[model samples]
Target: MKKFTFKIFAVAITLLLSTSLSLELLAQSAGYEVLFDGGSLEKWRSKSTPSSPIKGWKVEDGMLFMEGEGGGDIITKDKYGDFELVFEFNLTEKANSGIKYFVDTIYNEKSGEMKVNGPEYQIIDDYNYEGVKEDPNGTTSTGAAYLFYPPKNKQLNPHGEWNKGKIVAKGKKVSHWLNGKKLVSYTRGSKDYLKKKTANKFKDDKNYGELKEGHILITDHGDKVFFRNIKIKKL
Candidate 1:
């Protein structure tokens, strides 16, 4: 009878362990809204003309990808304020692309033009890409904020392999992560930010990075790049 009791007890322990493991996996996947699932583009639109249909971008083998020409920047239709975003990306040799956030598209009635731009999270082959090497500093390296806050201790996978990217924005604090490492962190609208904005290429723009809520953008930049598993969670 004692031996039988011991067997039952061991079975109960095993069941509990399995249950806990399942719950852990479920928890890790919670609180995310999938923007792209490798199947559709219902959540994205052309940044220049919001009402126009997206062109040149395609999904192949469960990955969103574009050629090295013609394809333009695409943005999320829904705007977000203070959120965490995750995505996986693969690049070709010497490829260049970017993920831009706090994107505000303003139509200029006076100039009869449409303008869309924002601070970009740089994406490129850091070692082989000419853009990084041409720069005196590594400000335009793979994980750096383009021409602004530079990421530290960069670690990127090979051009053909997929790499993980995370961007977290909560109030004034914003951070960029690549391959599970935190690379860039900065305070929005701080003195440092203002100083840099004043001198950057966006100096002419009145509201370059001042939006409290804005759309997320993926730039084409005439480079072949692939993306998948794009998800976000509001914070």
Candidate 2:
């Protein structure tokens, strides 16, 4: 009788564990996919690589690393029209970089296959990022949207430390987050959105906000910047 009771309890315990695991998996943010896994570039295409193919972007010590100068920006192989992307990034001291989406790549007469006309999530040394002026809004810091919008808080950690970031875009909804706190949100192409874009320097660029779908781009702004845990979900 004791043995039978023990067997029943073991089965119950196993079932409980299985259910708990399932719940945890389900709780994860849906419609998202991993862009990098510290292993291989399964969904990336380099515009700089032609013919023999260019391959220098790689993963090292669990962080994505880029080698040499003029490697060009790494972009998603598949274009995304609407998405919510989340990733972690750490910049070297005095590092400069950015994350841009819905960007159109253009080959100019001088520069070949360069990304143009996209809203950028400005990434830089918060304490040292330049050209910020005191304005009506109190968010003119490093994390601002390069002049259009400003983050509500400056919660980014120190240099060389991992920090969480997120970009959410669906229909007309777009949001930027850092360290689990929402910084700014606005519609992409609504009347108000277009009006604001016109008011800003992006006004002259007709390509601005015209792309309903485009490639996600990680900017290599001529600095040593490290990124990891990059993932995104379709919304």
lDDT of 2 by residue, 1-235 (tens): 9999999999998976565344334435454567876555667777555333446666776678667687667778778888888888887776777888887767775765554667778777765545333345533444556556788866988787888888988876788899989988877777877877778778888887678888888877677778887887887
User: What is the C-alpha local distance difference test score of each model?
Assistant: 0.85, 0.73
Index of the highest-lDDT prediction: 1
lDDT of 2 at 151: 88
Give the candidate number with the greatest TM-score.
Answer: 1
lDDT score, candidate 2: 0.73
lDDT of 1 by residue, 1-235 (tens): 9999999999998976565344435445798787886667899998877788888899876689885467689999999989999999998999889999989778898986667767788999886887688987667888888888888877899799999999999997899999989999988888998888887888787777778989999998887889988888899
Give candidate 2's error at residue 56 in angstroms: 5.0
What's the CA error at residue 158 for candidate 1, in Å? 1.9
